[model samples]
Target: MAGPVHPARGVSYPVTALFMVGVFLLGAAFIASYVGGLHAPHPHRVPVAVAGPADATARVDAALRREGDAFDLRTYPTTASARQAIQHRDVYGAYLPQQGRLLITSAFGPTTSGLLRSAFAPVAAADGLRLSVQDVVPADPGDPEGLVPFYLVIGWIVSAYLVAAIVGLYRGMAAITLRDALVRLAAFAVYSAVAGAMGTLIVETGYGYLPDSPWPLTGVGALCVFAVAAATAAAESLLGIIGTALTILVFVVLGNPSAGGPWPLPLLPAFWRTAGPWLPNWAGTEAVRNAVYFDGHALTRPLLVLAAYAAAGIVLFLLLAGRTNPVMRFPAHSTA
Candidate 1:
């Protein structure tokens, strides 16, 4: 007789396999995100406007062509048109021949601009031209160094999310239903308004750090806060305790360092640049800059992205909430 053949003890092989698969997926996610973030930008398809008189146009076009993979050059008859293109989102930048100046309006990461600036230098010299720099859309005065509005918005986002997370823990993730989700979101809106008002007031009147209309800042701040809180609530609803870690993974660890706040996206290493725009951190930063510096230009895309995140979170929380374990669920909490 064969010795007692004990069936597999503890976890079954299939269960172990499933567990391994989950681990693999998570690991893959981290690797893919991390590597994608670092991948080098080849200056592929970067739009630029070139403007000058007939001869100047031709010369500028030639120089831009020689500049290679970096520039997708478009020609304009006058500098005003180029500026218009930039303001209208037609181009990231424009070069003016008569003034020998380059106009930048887009809030591209700093590294990309630095690269362009340096590249323009050699080309300008070789072509017997001089270079001057102009920022059609400048940053806010109070924004610390390169990251002013970025950090401010980040602060608001973190606070709101912290509130949501705390509420979830204390109250227990509620038996969130469709109505409940909407109510939560509605509550989020009110909380957002308060947070935004306070943050904006502090930054503008309280500290005099930002020189801009306080109302606009407050409005934008409210939107940002809502987005973050909604997102946190949704994440907590989905992942239970793991949601907090995931939040750190997405918004803080990945979001902050990669946020174009301190160095601008381009100035960051390749990985950070690629991942920056996809995260709420980048969206919030861009939106803040648009409201304060870019004359409200270039804000639509980022705002839409943030709105999408908020909408998605609300939908997820409402739809799948019934399946959640009440004991493990996140109720009203503070993420601040």
Candidate 2:
């Protein structure tokens, strides 16, 4: 006789096939979105501070306008304010026509600095002058592409989600008490500290890719890791396995591409640019840049953003503890 026909084989086979197809589609979509979003970046109303006499400012503004809304030009009374604006992150670069100089912060990302340079070069050329480029905040030599901070943030985010997945797996296997949730959170805190230190050392000390003092970066990294991890834990606690997928969808798929790390915010399309500051990846990235290059200038916004995420995560985790799956529920009469 032929081998016994499996009772559920027909149904199982089709379900498995469909599941694999879904996985394929997910991968395809991820690739397409990332590639399409970043393949070619053009500036859109990139803020630039210009300091010069009235006639010179008018001339420069007219020239920039001809470039089709490529720059949002603002006139500063003096070069000092222009430099301050760049340091404050109000502008990516500045033009001082009196000195015929272009001020940039490579810490903003080399690609953005280059774009600013090219955009203003012709204006200077038209006046029979060569633009003097001044790097107010140069990127560390070891990180010429200025992507180490972004990679560090990405690493922290990955670790956070993975730890959340593991915690979720345990929750699936058995009920988790409030005390158990606290223990898991404490463990994540320790992990965040260790991961932050290790990442700071690797990038700042080992590779010399970040010139900032290691302590601030370490602290920021710790906060970032904790924020992501706590947020993931809260997600998993509230949503179960689906929460893990949501974490990936939010942090990885949506957050990473719009992060403004590889390309500064000005170069990104409108949606991503608008969303970048609201995301953890961009917040962490900008905080790191400020710590390393701008002497922590304009660090408040990004730090506040990270802090908000961390706070919300902790609150959510506490609220959701002991309230999820019955398998993780505490027995009604048990004190423990």
Candidate 3:
């Protein structure tokens, strides 16, 4: 009733079945990563400044540590010095005992600022001082929660993978020539630039957010997009469709929830906080945030990280391009 089986078709069934199993594992890991990572985020080592003498600062530190290893307290001799530390991005908030004030930068993230308020309220009460709050570097009124930069970074990342998907599918992921790789890399660069510019334009116009920062934002977006796309392309060159899925596992499932977008790093659990800065998702988000909010302070490291990814991808694709992934090959075998 059934036709004779072709050697190639019968030989590759195991590979197809393995791919399905991989998909199932990926789905399980996605749930474990997102829900498990984000379910109950509390502060870990939030750095904050306190303006007072050594004895006074020690007392405050003792109080905070009693709660948990939540706040990493830094002491400054005066309120002015503490405020300077915040502006320099050395600390998130500063408490001035004499002034009875809590100076915070909501621009870092409203969640951090809120945590500072709650943590200091009891301290202020114990000191018999009424706490008055001041936002030193507040979020832009247009972007209240300071999430525009994160969303923009997410857009760049999504566009990058899409570019890889389209180009890899067109050029045949199972096999690529040197010329095909070069052309795909060139296309990635051009698409990244256009996508970055258009993304910047839309965000600037629609939300009226991140004014006076189009050029730097575009640069960040382009670099982020290119970094992701090139790496994805390289992966496809090596492993075919499985490589694409690997990037999703690395960049999406692991990177996004740990990116510190919804909250700052201090507010996340230890594992996510530790992994945040190393990922492209976090770098892109912080680069855009710095470009818009902090006058581009501490931006070099993130740029370097992105450039490294781009460089590594280019190198790998050039080396591996023309080689057929063994997993993708279905060779005929003779029956005994």
Candidate 4:
């Protein structure tokens, strides 16, 4: 026979059960949200260019619109101009109506190229012509799926927050001085440099993926790591333990889905599409891609966004440090 339970013990049982239930709910929510967002991706207004006679262009535009708003159509004077648009990242794919040729960049992602092919094949078939596909920029052989950029960004993000969390745990926010904060920032910088170099080596040399020179990739990686680490440190300084939770909420819950990693931004739902460009994941991924494939076209915007985040985080951290320990001022009237 069991003895009667103590009051504290009985209370603890329900508390433990509640905590377990909360953990389960959080896990369940993460899975459900990601799966729901990515289950069936449909293009909303994916940009595509067409170059041909005015009559042919009008017919193609009408067909694209009839296909359920799958494309945002642009007209180019020549097929060469349309190809240039694809290379410049202005359009995902281009069509030459007269030649029945489709120009796509598999460098973006094989899935994107596949989708474009499927969408345009029917249009070409309607004209009793076979669609001739041309990949102007194909992905590296080592990363045929074109997911290396996304995975690389993910690695940087996880390392950034984990490093910040460990530092915060070692030195509680209340006990952290301005010197301590600066030291932490210094450590983060060194770690970012090392991590960036190592990651670049692994992706470029070891695996033979990512055709860009290591220097540019390493530079972008370092910036990405520093941006995330500084922001996470600032969050922790301001909010204590809850700051870590906030970091996860921002980087994991919202950032990942809207990152345009597995699917391009134009194919996502409205909310994710709108939010993708603003988030670090998308910025970092795009920056890496540009550095590798597009000769660094359209890189300035993402770099600026990352710089802003790093600056904001550093400023906030300093402000918090000042609040915690006010500097003592000596009166001018008194001499030593």
User: Would you estimate the TM-scores of all the predictions?
Assistant: 0.74, 0.89, 0.90, 0.88
Distance from true position, residue 157, model 4, in Å?
A: 0.9
Write model 2 residue lDDT over 132-207, tens digit each, in one string.
Answer: 9999878877777888889989998888779778867755422257787678778889999998899999887787
For each candidate, how many residue pairs have backbone atoms clashing (under 3 Å)? 30, 1, 0, 0
- Residue pairs that clash (backbone atoms under 3 angstroms), model 2: 175-328
Q: What's the lDDT for all of these models? A: 0.71, 0.81, 0.84, 0.81
lDDT of model 3 at residue 207?
Answer: 70
Number of the top-ranking candidate, with lDDT as the measure: 3
Model 2 spans with C-alpha error above 4 angstroms: 1-22, 173-175, 326-336
RMSD of each: 8.3, 5.6, 4.1, 8.3
Weakest 10 consecutive residues, lDDT, candidate 2?
327-336
Q: Per-residue CA lDDT of candidate 1, range 150-235, in tens?
A: 76888987897788888777644543566766777788889999998988887788767667667777877887788888888878
How many Å off is the CA of 84 in candidate 4?
1.5
Worst 10 residues of 3 by lDDT: 327-336
- Which residue pairs clash within candidate 4? none
- What tens-digit string does per-residue lDDT give for candidate 3 at 97-129? 665689998886678888999988888888888
After superposition, which runs of candidate 1 have C-alpha atoms over 4 Å from their true positions? 1-46, 53-55, 61-68, 105-114, 141-144, 176-183, 263-275, 321-323, 326-336
TM-score, ranked from best to worst: 3, 2, 4, 1
lDDT of 4 by residue, 1-336 (tens): 556544343345665676577567667766865776577788988999999999989988988988788789999999889988987889999988887889998876777889889988888888888999998888887777788988988898888889887877666542357887788789989998988898899888888889557998898889888998888888877776557767776777677777878888888887778887887888888999988888888899889978887899888887787444222111223222
- Candidate 3: stretches off by over 4 Å: 1-14, 329-336
